[model samples]
Target: MSARMTDAEARERMDEITRPEKPFNRFRWTITVALLVLFFGTSLTVDISPSALLALPERTLFYLGLMFLPPDLSEVGRSFNAMVQSLGMAWIGTIIGAVLSFPLAFLAATNLASKPVVFAARQILNFFRAVPEIVFLILLLPITGLTPVTVALALGISSIGTLGKLSAEVIESIDPGPVEAAAATGGGRLQRIRWAVVPQVIPEIVALWLYRFEINIRNSAVAGAVGAGGIGTLLVREIQLLRNWATAGTALAVMVIVTLIVDTISGRVRRRIIRGPQRPVDIGADTLPPDADRDAGPDLPNDPGEAGPRTFAPI
Candidate 1:
């Protein structure tokens, strides 16, 4: 009994010794403090004040009330027209961007191109991505004037950077097995890409293009504010020049409705594209052996002697 008690005490002590300890992470706390200080310091440098932030909600509510009161339906016709124009601009721009970026994407992909090519392609993409659509519009306005074409061109040019970058990432992530298989079959670089990479990445790339289209729509509306020929122009005219709050509110509402509808449709399509096709499971078939039928054939002459080992002459 004493030995048993000693063994139990030993086991208990072992458990205590082996148990894990949860140590306080002083380093984590130190990092958190440092980040907080940096954030506050930056906020101070930017002249961001807590008092101004606190007053924002009340001011926002007041503005909303002013905009919504007696919502004007008179501008519906013009608003709808401008909205349609914006949609057209976004569609054309996105299509153009996708077309132009498709080739650049392959060139920029590290898996497909050399370091120098990838670096140069990435720098070009970065330049376009860094410039906003509005800036593009500003620069092009002199050439294209204040037309919807200007907005479309601006949006397309800016979108190429994003689309190319994302497409390159997609290309880089494609499965190498098919590519290797193609090369094994004596395929050249282009042939390998056609037979292997394009099939695997096109669907996702297309989905990304659709997503960019949705974004471009919103951007096109904003571009219109600067007289680029969309609802935004009308919106600015009513709100800033005519001071027709009701008309401006109507235009804003129309823009929101159209944008929301496009976003919802595009989002659904993107999800479907990403999920790919669903295949039905064959539960019974899955359980069956590959040679089940052959295995079920009459037991190969239980005794080879009984069947007298049959032989056939070669044809």
Candidate 2:
């Protein structure tokens, strides 16, 4: 038979389970302190009386209840046209940016450019990215006489900087072995780039281009503020005229549709590119072995026998 445990013994066992000296969770403690400060600061600065906050949900419900009424489908045709125009502007801008940035992206990537040139090109890309697209829209309106074309130009210019920087990074991060192999085999710079570097990075760059198209769509929507033409101009007009109901409806619809379409399409495209079949590498019959080129007779008249029947050369 065992002796019955004392109360002190049971308490000691419970204390071991609880571990009183264990450290507090740092993340949780930090979050608690942050919330306390935020609440105190908000209380001190804002005129958010207890009554106002308590009644806030009621006020919000009133506005949402009004929105349940059917949207003014009377202007459906006009709205549809405006949306189409906005889409067209976005499409054109994305095309221009994607096409124009290819060379710049290559130039800015150290793998493709001379070391010095790439350094300078990267700085130029950084400078362009620092300026907001809206600023470009504002600057170009006066010069180009305010049109969808101006918006496209502005969006394209600003996009090139961001696209180039991202593309360069992708290019730079690729495996260097294939490129080195190509170069060591007596391939010229262009040949090495075409066969090795481009093959690895093309899928990623194309994915980036598609992603940029989605972003351009959003940028175009907001470019209308500076007379760069789009649905934003109509939305602005509605707001300025105190058509709050119409403004609210349009704003909500735009937010929902753009978010849904961009997230769905970009996600699908990214997955497809990542999982796509890679380009097959062809080992040419005429391609040189690594050391074969070094043994080739110096550029002088040599007998066919001396050159070993010219079995290998750079592909």
Candidate 3:
């Protein structure tokens, strides 16, 4: 009986370790009810005339039936080519954003590190985050020839701001003790960042990268509407000709399948990152393998001493 009681106590203590305390807030329920009421009232007031409302249910059913068209297997080859192009654009854009965002993220995490240069970097990140991707596509259309490059550039630019801000937030929230330890050990600015900050945030950053890839896949399709050249152009053409059923069919199929596949893959990757090492344990302590070090590279410094490295401010 005493042993069982001790075991129960141990389990209770373990549960406490895993369960975090939630900060209480009084406004959440009130805010939710207010928003719901406002939306319900606004929707009721909107004059959705009788004919349109009556047509909606029938149209929905008709489109739902179109899903059984056996998937236009004849157009498979053409659709595959277009999908490949859009995916290529997504890949190119994601790579560009990942490459650009690394150093910028270090600069943007101004709350964790309040260097004047870092503050400036944060402002630049804010500028990029504020602009919508569609707007960038328009701006890039004239400058860069209207090819996949234009779409890729627009997606990449939009992604950089989003990724930088997210990465910065992750960096800012890290425990400062590790950073202090690294500095105390005589690690240089870059080394300190490498050993302390990047080690902690790499999993979060990789998760973000995967998530951005999924987002870019969707964005690439939308970009095709502007002659960016993908399914969007096809959808636009169908809509212009009043081929509503076909347009609806293609959209529904693509949205369901593409989203499912990307979501599944990204979820798996994110889970792997969050969980501890899935494979054999590493015994090495101080030194990293040359390959690992080479792949990751040195981390960017948060501290901007006199004359920091010249970095492009995002805007």
Q: Best-fitting candidate, measured by TM-score?
A: 1
- Residues 1-315 of candidate 3: C-alpha lDDT, one tens digit per residue: 364657779898787786566766669978988999999998889987878888999987776676446455555455556666777788899888988998899988865566987878878888888987789899989899778888888889888888998888777877677788778767888877887788777777777887888888888876656777766655565555556655446654665576678779877776666554656435453355566645754452332211111221211
User: Taking the tens digit of each residue's C-alpha lDDT, what string does model 1 give over 1-315?
Assistant: 364657779888787786577798999989999999999898888967888899999987876777788787888898989999989999999998999899999999999999999999999999989998888888999998988998999899999999999989888977788788778767799978886888778777888899899989888876746877888788878778888877778889999998999899988787666664355423355454788647855432111011111121111
Best by lDDT: 1
TM-score of model 3 (CA atoms): 0.71
What TM-score should be assigned to candidate 1?
0.74
lDDT at position 141, candidate 2: 81
Descending-lDDT candidate ranking? 1, 3, 2
Q: Model 2: which residue pairs collide?
A: none
User: How many pairs of residues in model 2 come into backbone collision?
Assistant: 0
True lDDT of residue 292, candidate 1: 66
The C-alpha RMSD of each candidate to the native structure, in angstroms, is 13.6, 9.5, 11.6
| Clash numbers, per candidate | 0, 0, 0
Runs off by more than 4 Å, candidate 2: 1-7, 16-68, 242-244, 247-255, 277-315
Residues 1-315 of candidate 2: C-alpha lDDT, one tens digit per residue: 248778888798787896468677999999999999999998889876888889999987776655435665565456556666777777788778888888788889976799899988888888778998888888888898778888888888888888888888878877787778777766698878777777777777777777787777778766657645567766666555655665456554664576567758886876566555344434352465566545653432111111011111101
Instruction: Give candidate 1 regions above 4 Å deviation.
Output: 1-39, 42-58, 279-315
